[model samples]
Target: MLTKPKILVVEDEIIVAVNLGQKLKKLGYDLVGITSSGEEAIQKAEENHPDLVLMDINIEGNLDGIQTAELLRNRFQTPVIYLTAYADENTLNRAKRTQPLGYIVKPFESDQLRSSIEVALYKNELEHRNRKNEESLKSTLNQMESGIITTDENGLVLFCNPVAEKIAGLSYAESIGLSLTKILKLEDSTSSSYTLPLSDVLISNQTIEKNGIFAVDGIGNKTAVSIQISPILNTEGKSSGSITVLRLGESDNTNQSYLKEIHHRIKNNLTVISSLLSMNASNLKDQETLDIFKDSQHRIQAVALLHEVLYENHDLSSISFDLYVRKLTDLLFEVYKVDRSKFKLVLDIQTPKIPSEMGMNCALIINELLTNSFKHGFKGRESGSILIRFSLNDEQYFLEVKDDGVGLSDDTIAQTRNSGSLGLSLVDSFVKLLRGKLKLENENGCKVTLSFPTRHET
Candidate 1:
C-alpha cells in the first residue's frame, strides 16, 4: 500500500545505467530516468527532483559523480548515494568531504543495492526528524517566560528564541552564529565564562546551571542585566554547548507598561505627602513630635524613591541599587540640613542594581539607622562622625553603620530583647524582611551591623 520512493541513477556506462534502473524498479522503487553523464544528471535533477540520487564515480561526463553530487547538494539539499565498482582509499576519502548518505562498491549484488537504498532512505528520514525537532525546540523556547538562546561548541549561536531576541534587544538574524560577546555586547568583551553551564556540558557531557553578570546592552543604556544559562546535551552525552535563559521579571507586554505608568503617579503622590510633613514639622514647637514626623517623612521618601526608580525604568524585577542608595543619601542630607563643616557623613557603598523589592528594603533600613543616629545618638551636639560600609561575605551582605555618638542602653538591646520593644523591634522587622541577622555593638559609640544573605542572582 506504500508509494515507492522515486530514485535517479547516474552512471556513465549505458549498460550499467540500464541494469541499475531495472534492478531499482524490481525492488519496488519508481524508476526515474537514468543519466549517462554528470552534466545530464545535474540537468535532470533540476528538471525533475527525485527523492534520492544513486551516483557513479568514474563516469563518462565532464564532471564526475562526486562533483555532480556536490552541485545537487549545494543547489537542492537532495541526499546522494554513491555507486562505484571499487572502494579506493583516495576516492572514498574525497567522497567523505561531500557527506554522501550511502556508498555502494562495484560488483555488488541485488541485496547490496537494496540494503544501500534502504539505509539511505532511513538516514534521510532521521535528518528530517532532526530538522523538525529543531523547529519544535525553537517554538518551545519562544513560548518560555524567560529568554533562551543556544550556542555550538565554538560558542557560535545556533538558535535564539523570540524572548531572547526581545530581551537582548536584537533580532534573530543578528544573533544566530554570532560570537556571544558581539551579541551580548559585554564591556570587556573578554569572552568571560558567563556560560558556566555550557562549559559543564562540554566537560561532564551533562546539563549545567550557571549565572553571570551581563553588561549594559549595545544601546548604551547604562544598565546591566543578569543571565542564567544551562547546557543542552545530546543522547550520547556529548558537549553540545548551552542555552541561556534570561529572567527580566515577567515583562507583561499586555498590561505591564500601563501599570508602570500608574505606579509613577503614586510615587509622585508620596513625594507630596513628604512635603506636607516637612511643612508641618517646621511648625511644631515640640521637638519630639517634630522628630517623629521627620522620621516618618524619611521612611515615606524611602518607599517613594523605589517607586520613582521603578516608575522610570518600569522593570519590576530589578532596581538600580547604586542609584537608589546614592539618591536616598542625598535626600537625607538635604532634609536634615546638617552642617558639613561640623559633622561628616562617609559612605563606602558598592553593589550592582537589584530588584525593587531588595532596593526598597535596603533604603528603608538605611534611612531608619541614619535618622536614629541624628536624633537620640547625637542628643547634645550637632556635630559627629558616621561611617557606612557596605560589604558582602560568602552568601551574606554586611551593612555596618558606625557613629561616634551615644549608643543604645545595655538592657534595651540585650540578647534577650523581645518583640515588646518598639523602635528597635521595627529595626528587627526590617532585618527579618531581608532574611538576615542584626547585631548592635556599643564599643566607643553605636555600631549597627546588619548581615543578610544575598537574593537570587542571575
Candidate 2:
C-alpha cells in the first residue's frame, strides 16, 4: 500500500512541461502540477505539497527557479533538482549555492531523474526517523523518578533529566552545558565534603555506588541521596561520558518522632496505673491483699519498662532482651527490698533481641519465675545464686532460669501443678500463649526451661 512519490514540474515551455509530466507518470511517480513561472511554481508547491520539485533554472519570473527552489527547500524541506540548459561554470557555481539535490541538463533521461528522486527520498526518511528516536529518548529520561545526568569526560553536563533538575533546584537549561561540580554539592553523612564519583568512573570505566551522601541543592536545601555512577562508553569501547543516577534516601525522622510520642503517652499511663495500685495497697490493712496488689503492680511495671525502652531505643520493633532482663531483675530486687549482695545473679543471654510483643511476654514470665524463686526457693536463706540464660537454636527460642536454693520435693511439685497456685498457673498459661513447652527440674535446685519456635509476625 505504498503511495507513489509526488513530483512538481516548473518549466516555461508548454511542450517540455507536458512531456515531463507524461514521463514522470510513466516512471511510476504522481504528477502534482505543472507551472511556467517561479511564483506559480511556489504556489503549486504550497498547495499540492509534492515530495520532489523539478525546477528549470531559467523560469518566467523575477525570482528565478533557483530562487523558488531555495524558498521551497527552506519552508517545506522538499528536495529539488535543477533542470537547465546552462551547464557553464558560472551557472553551476550559482546553482550549487541553492543546494539542489541533483543538477540535470536539458533533455535528461527518465532513469537519471528517478535515481536522483529515490536517493533524496530515502535520505529524508532516515533523518526523520533519527529525529523521532531522539525525541522519544528525551521523553523517557525526563519521566524517570530517579535523578539522571549525563556529562562529558571534561565534567561538563550534556543532559540532565527533569528529576535531576528538581533535585539540584536548577532548570535543565541552567544545568546543561555547565560544569557538574558547579551545579551540585555533595557531602557524606559524617560531614566530609567530596566531589561525585562520576569523574573517577570516567577514568576507570567502572561503576560506583555511594550511600548516605547528602545532596545540597542550589538553594542550600539538603536531602539524603544514594548515588550510582557508571561510565558511558562509545562504540569504540572507550569512555565518552559518565551517567550518574541519584536516588533519594529513606527518611526515618517522621517514624521515630511518631514512635516517641506514642511511647511517652503509654509510659505515662502505665506510671499512673502503678501509682493507683500502690495507693490501694497502702489503704489495705490485710497482708495478703497488699501482696496481691504489689504483684499486680510489678507485672504492670514489667510492661511499662518495655515502652520506656522502645522510646529510648533507635529501633522501635525490638529490644535487647539481655539488657532488659538485667534491668528488670534489678527492679524486682528493689521492689521486694531483697539484699542483691547476698544473692548473686548470673546472666548468659545469647538471644540479643526479640520482637517487642514477644519481649513483653518473656518479661512477665521472667518476673513470675524470679518472684517465685525469691519468695519460695530462697525463703529464710541469706546467700543464693540465680542464673538466667536465653538462646536460639534451630529456629527455637530457649529461656532457662536456675536457682541454687532449697529444691522442691516431688510431692510439692505435684501439688503446685495440680492445685491452682496462681504464680505457677500464670507461668503455665504464658507458655501455652507462646505455643511452647516448659519443664521444671529440682535435682540440685529449681531449674525452669521454656522452648518456643521463633514465629515471625505477619
Candidate 3:
C-alpha cells in the first residue's frame, strides 16, 4: 500500500495553522506537526522528515520562514511551498531567492493549495528518481575494467572513470572541461599521419572503432590500446555528446604468462613421475623387468622434455623438432652408457618446428626405435652407427631410423609384425594412432620407416 504524503505546516496565526492541518487531512495527507515560529518549524521538520513544508514568509521568532525553508532545503533536501499574506514586490523577490516549489497568497482556496502541493510532490519524486539513477550509473562506470570517458558535443570532457584517469595520466579534476584530444593522445601504431576519428563519430552519429593504436601519455610513453567512440544522442535523435571506451591491446601477455606457468607445472609433475619410476627400477633384479621400468621412465621423460621446451620458449603452440631431437639423443646416449668413440649417432632433421602433440608422439616413437637399436640390434656389437632422419614433403612427415648392426631374421620380422614383442607392439600401435604407414626391413642391418600426414590434413 502507498503511504500518504506527510506535510508540515508552519504558520504564525493559530486559526490559519489549524485550518491548514484540517485541509491536509481531508486531502489524504498526513499532518506531521504545526509550528508558529521559524525555529520550532525547523525542529518539527527535522523530527518528522516531511515530504512537503507549507512555510509562511512572516513567521514568529528571529528566523523567518524564508530563512527556515532555505536551511531545511540545504540540510534535508525538503521541498517547500510558500503560504504568505505578503505578496508585495520586496517580499516576493526575497521569497524567490529561497527557491520555494509553490507559492499561495493569503486567503487561498483548498483547490489551489492542493494543486500546488500535488505538482510539487510529483516534481520532487521525479528529481529523486533521476538522482538515484545517475548515482547508479556512475557506480557501474567506476567499476568497469575498460576506460570510459564522456564528452559534450564540442568534445569537451564531461566525465571520466578511474580507468580513464589512469590511462590518460590525469586526475578526474584535471580532465574535466579539457578537450577530448587534450585528454587522450592516440595515434595508429602502424602509421604516423593517423588522426582520431572523433569528428566522424560526432557528425555521423555512429560508433567508430580503431585497433592496434598507441595511447601516448603526458610523459611521452606509449601503450598499446584499442578504442571505440560512440555518439550519445539526445531525445531528438541528434548527437548530444560522445562516449569513448579504451581497452588495452596487450592483455594477451597475461594469458601467455599463464600458459607458460601451466607448462612449467606439467613438466615438473612429469619429471617427478619419471623419478619415481627410476627409483622403482633400481630395486628390480630381473633384467627384463628392469628394462621395462627403464623404458617407461624414458617415455615419461620424452613428454616431460617437450613441456620443458615449451616452458622455456616464447611460442607455446609448437616447438623446434630439430633441437628437441638433439637433446633427446644426447639423453638416450648417456642413459645407454655408449662410448662416444665406439658408437656414432647421426641426426638429419629437416623439419624445424611441429605442433606439441605431434612432436610428443614423434618423440616417443623415436625413443622406442633408439631403445630397440641399443638393446637388440647392437647387442654384442662393440662398434656401430645409428642414423635418424626426419623430413617433410607433400603435406606429410617422413621419419627413418637405420642402424648398422645384427639385422632381424625373416622369422623375427614376421613375429614383430604379428605384435609378438611388447616393444614392437607399442610401435605398431603408435603408427596406427598417427594414421601413418610403417615399414620394417633389413638393409645392411635394421631399418624402420614411418610416414604420416600433417596434423591439419587429419
Candidate 4:
C-alpha cells in the first residue's frame, strides 16, 4: 500500500490547526503533526520528515514561521506552503524571501489548499528525480576510461572526470574553478598556426577533432593525446558549453617491446618443438613414417619463421610478407635439397605487411602448396620452375602459385577433391578460415589461385 503525502501544520490558533488537520485528512493527505510554535514546528518536522509543511507565518515563537521555513529549506529541503491571515506587501515580501512553494490566506477554501499542496508535491518529486539523474551521470562519467572535461561558455572548468584529473595531473579541487587553459595545458607543434583554441571553438559553436596533440602537466610531463571537442547547446539551440574527450596516445616503445617479446618466445618454443620432431624422425627406420614426421616438422618451421620475422622487425604487429616469402622459399629449398641449377624459384610478393596470425596461416598454406609441387609435380623432371605471386587490392588478397612441371589429369584433380590427403585438408580448412575461394587448374602446368578479404568482416 502507498503511504499518503504527509503534511505538517504549524498554526498557533488551536481551533484553526484542528480544522486544517481535518481538511487535510478529508483530502487524502496524512496530517503528521500540528504545532502551535515555530520551535515545535522544527522539532515535529525533524521527527516526521513530512512531504509538505503548512506553515503559519504569524505563528508564536522566537523563530517566526518564515524563519522556520527558511531553516527547513536550507537544511532538509522540505517544501513549504505558507498559511496566514496576513496578505500585506510586507508579509508577502518576507515570505517570498523564504522561497515557500505556495502561499494561502488563513480562511482559504479546502479546494485551494488541496491544489497548492498537490502542485508543491509534484514539483518537489521532479526536483529529487533530476538530482538523482545528475548524480548517476556524474558516476558514469567518472568511471569512463577516456578523459572527459566539460566547461562553461566562458571556458571555465565546470566538471572533470577522474580520468581527466590523472591525465592532466590536477586534482578536482584545484581544477573546478580554473580556466581550461590553465588546468589542461595543450600544445600542438604539428598543428597550423591558424588552428583555433578550444574557447574559440566554443564561441564558433563548432566541433573539432585533432590528433598528435600534447598535454603538459604541472610537473612538466608531456603526454600525447587525441582530442575531440563538441559544443553543448541549450534548448534554444545556442551553445552553452563544450564537452572535450581525450584519448591517450599508444605507448609506442612499451607496446612494441611487449609484442616483440611475445613473438620471440613463440618462435623459440616452436623451434624447440621442431627440433624434437627432427630427432624423432631420425630414429624412424620406415621411410613413409619418416616422411610424415618431416612434413609436420616443416609445417611447424613455417609458422616459427613468421614469428621470427615479427620479433625482429620494427613493426611487431605485422610481418613484411614479401621479405617473409623470400626467406620461406629459401628455407624450403634447403630442406628439399633442390639443386639450384635444375630448378628456379621466382617470387613476386607485392603485398603489404599483414598481421602476424594471418602471416602464419599464409606461410603454412604456402608451405603445403610448395611441398606438393616439389614432391609430385617434379617427380621425374630434371629442370622446372616454381613461381609464387601475392598481391592485395582494396577489398581482397590474391595469391597464385604456378609450376612448369608435369601436370595432373582432370580425373586426378576431381578425385583429389574427395581424397582425405592431410595436406589438402589442411589447405581447405585454412581457406575456409580466411573466408576465401580456391581454384586449381592444369594448363600445361599446375596453377592455383586463392582470393579472400584483406580484413576480417565481423
**Which candidate number has the best lDDT?**
3
Displacement of the residue 355 alpha carbon in candidate 4, Å:
40
lDDT of 3 by residue, 22-43 (tens): 9889889999999999889888
Q: What are the per-residue Cα lDDT tens digits for candidate 1 across 1-458?
A: 88789898888788878988889888899987798888888788888888899998888768988888999988988889998878679878888998899888877789999998999999998998998998897777778866677888777888887556645555677788887656765332354534333455556655444333444543343223446655566787666677666655433455667867678688779988999999888999998788678778878878888877665454677765555676787787777776767878787764434556766776787887777777678889868998887766687778888888898778766851373434566677778888888888896788988888777443
| Candidate 1 lDDT score at position 382 | 68
Clashing pairs in 1: 85-106, 318-355, 319-354
Best-first order by TM-score: 3, 4, 1, 2
Q: Which sections of candidate 4 miss by over 4 Å?
A: 84-99, 189-196, 252-458
Backbone collisions counted per model = 3, 0, 0, 0
List TM-score per model, in order.
0.48, 0.46, 0.51, 0.50
- Higher-scoring candidate on TM-score, 2 or 3: 3
Evaluate model 3: give its lDDT.
0.84
Taking the tens digit of each residue's C-alpha lDDT, what string does model 4 give over 154-211?
Answer: 8888999866875676756668978877788777856422233777687788899988
Shift of residue 124 alpha carbon in model 1, Å: 0.8
Q: Name the best candidate (by TM-score).
A: 3
Worst 10 residues of 4 by lDDT: 189-198
lDDT of 2 by residue, 179-240 (tens): 88888788887877868766678888999998888877643556678899889899988899
The TM-score that candidate 1 achieves is 0.48
| Cα lDDT listed for each candidate | 0.74, 0.82, 0.84, 0.82
